[model samples]
Target: MYITMEPGSELAWELYAGIDEAGRGPIVGPLIIAGVVISGKCMNKLSTLGVKDSKQLTKAQREKLIDVIYESARYIIIAEIPPHLIDAYNINMLEEDTIAYLVSRIVAVNSHLKLKEISIDAVGSSKQLAQKIREVVPKSVRVVIEEKADRKYVAVSAASIVAKVWRDRRIDALKTIYGNFGSGYPTDPNTRRWIHDMYSLDPYNPPPIIRRTWGTLKTLAPLWYKKKRQTVAGREKTQKTLADFLPKI
Candidate 1:
C-alpha cells in the first residue's frame, strides 16, 4: 500500500528503503523483520497501493495490499527469528541481530543496483543501533535508523505491515494448538494468566513455543533462577568460609 509523507518536502534520495519488525512485544512467536525499497518515481504507486502503517489497516486491507507491495516494490525481504534463539540471546540482542540480518538481505538484493541510502525504524537507541549496524555493514552503504520511522517513512510502514501480517498469521496458527493466548503482550492479562497457569501445572517446563526469556516467564519462574543463583551463591560463601578456617603456612 502506498502511503505518502505530507507534501512540500523535497525528496532527496533516489532509492529509499524502510525497515521494521513485528513480534518484538509478543511473548509467543518469532520476531519478524521486513524491509521495503521504493524510489521517488514509484512513491505515488505505493501510495495508491493503500500503504499506511499496518496498525491503521484492517486485516482485509492489509491482506489485499500485501500482494500489491510485493509487485510494486524494488525489493522486499523478511526474516523470522525463532523462540529458542530469543531465549538464548535475549530480546534486545535478538532485535539487533534480526535487523542486521534483514539489512544484510536488503544489501544483497540491492547489490546489483548499487544503492546507497536505507532507513530503518529505530529498534533501540537509534544512534547506538545504527552504529552497531554500521559496524557490521559494509562501508559502501549508508544506514539511517530513526525513531517512529514507520510513521514517518512509507518504506518503513510497508515493512511494518508485512512483518505484522506475517506475525499475525503465525499467532493465529499457534492458537490452534495452544488456544487463545490473547495478543501475547505482557500487558494482556489473559496472556499472562495463560503463561502462569501453564507453568503452574508443568513447573520448570514451559510450552515448547513460549519465549521463556520474557519478563513474564522470569516472573512466573522465579524459583527456577532463584534456586540456581542460590546454589552458586551458597557454594561461593561456603568456599570462602572453608578457606578462612584452613591453616595457612
Candidate 2:
C-alpha cells in the first residue's frame, strides 16, 4: 500500500541550499551550524524579505525574520557543537564534518526537492572545503564555498541569521546559569575577569560550559598561580612577624 521512493530522483522542484555557522571564535558557548534549502521562487522572496548577512541585522531584526525564513524555506537543518567537542576536535575538521552531515541530512530528508547547488560561507581553503562537500552531495549538486557568501547569497544569509539567533539564545541561557560573561569572547574584558574569577574559585576544574582547553585559561593560569604563591608567602611572613612580637615560651 506504500510506494518506495529513492532519494535524489523524481525531483519536482529545483532548490539551492546555503550553509553557515556561528560562535566559531567565542571562547564560550556551542558552535551553531545551519543550512537552508529553498526553491528558486522562495530565494527571491527571501531577498525581498530583506534577508542579508546576520551580522548586518540587529537582534530584533533577526528575530523578526526567523519565522518568515522558516515559512519560506522548503527545508532547514541546524547542528550544535558543544564546548567540550570543540575542545576535543580541530575546529576546521569539526565544521567540515558538520557541513557534510547537514548536506547529507537535508538531501535525505527532502529528497523530493532537487538541490541544484549549495553555497557555504567558507571557514578556510574554499577550494578544499568545496571538494569535501562535493564528495558527500550528489554530483549534480554544485558546491560553492566562498568567504562572505552570506552577504552575497540570500540562502546563505538566511542560514547565517538562523545560526546567529540560535547561538544568541544559547548564550542567553548560559548567562541565566553563569551570570553575564560579556559576549563570551576572549577579547572581552568582562569575559577575562569572569575567567579569572572562575579560576580563583577552583583552579583545577572549571564549569562544563567553559572551553577549558582555550588559550585564555593558559594565559590566566600563570598570573593567578603567581598571586597564589605571593599570598602564601605574605601569610608566612605575617606569622613570623607576630611570633617575633610575642614573648617566647
Candidate 3:
C-alpha cells in the first residue's frame, strides 16, 4: 500500500535511515541505490555488529550482514539504473531522481513507519544535493546529506553493504553473459584489454554495454585512434607536397 504524507517542515522521529549506492564509478554493471530503515532499538545494535562502510567489509561479511540488516530493517528498498538508461540520462540528475524515488518509495510503502531522519553519502559532495533530495521527499523526513555518510552513520553503512552486494550480483550476472572484464573500471588492465578487443573487432560499434559516451572509450578505442592517424596523414601530406606551379627564382 502506498501512502503520501502531507509535505511538512523538517521533522524528527526516533527511527533513522541511511542511504548509499554502489557501482557509481564502475564502467560496467548498473548503478544501485539502497536504503535501510532502523529505529532507535536496532541502530546501536547494527553498529556493534561491525557495520561501518561496505568498502571496509569483505564480500563474505557483506553477504552475512545482508541477512542481519533484513532482520532488523523496518523497510529496505533498492533502485537500479542500468547502463543503457544511465547513458540516456544525465548521471547526476539520474542519481538525485533515483535517491528521491527510493527514499520516498520506502516511506510511502511503509506508510505506517515513523521515520525521523535519513542520512545519505552525497553523490558529489554537495549540501545542495541533499537539499534537493529532501525537497522531493515528504518534508517530515528530515535529511542529513553529507560526504561519507556511510562511514559516519551505521544505517548508511548497512545500506552501503546491501548496495554493494546487489552490484556484485549484477556484475556476476554480466560476467556470465559477456565473459570477464576484470573489476569493470578503467584502471583494470583486464577491463582495458577487453575494451581494446571490442574496439578492434567492432570499431564503430562496440557492445551497448560499453559506455560509449565515456572518455575512456573515445580516448582508448580504435575509432578515435584511426581518426587521429588519418588526420596526421593529411598533415604530413600538406607538409611534404609543394604547389605544382611554384615559380623557380
How good is model 2 by TM-score?
0.82
Candidate 1 per-residue C-alpha lDDT over 158-242 given as tens digits, one digit per residue, 9 for 90 to 100: 8888888988888899889988888888789989888777777878666767776566666765533222112242233222322
Q: In model 2, what are the clashing residue pairs, if there are any?
A: none
Local error of candidate 2 at residue 101 (angstroms): 0.8
The residue-by-residue lDDT of candidate 3 on 16-44, one tens digit each, is: 87889998787767888888877777888
**Selected candidate, larger TM-score, 1 vs 3:** 3
TM-score of 1: 0.75
CA-lDDT, candidates in order: 0.69, 0.77, 0.71
Candidate 2 lDDT tens digits, 1-249: 011122232246678889999999988889899988888888888899899999999999999998888777777778777887666555676687677777777677665567788899998557666776776788877788899999998889999999999899989999999888889998999998988888888787777777766777668754332211122422333223222332222
TM-score of every candidate:
0.75, 0.82, 0.79
Which 10-residue window in model 1 sums to the lowest lDDT?
1-10
Q: List the residue pairs that clash in candidate 3.
A: 13-116
Error of 1 at 147 (Å): 0.5
Compare the candidates by lDDT and give the number of the best one. Answer: 2
lDDT order of candidates, best first? 2, 3, 1
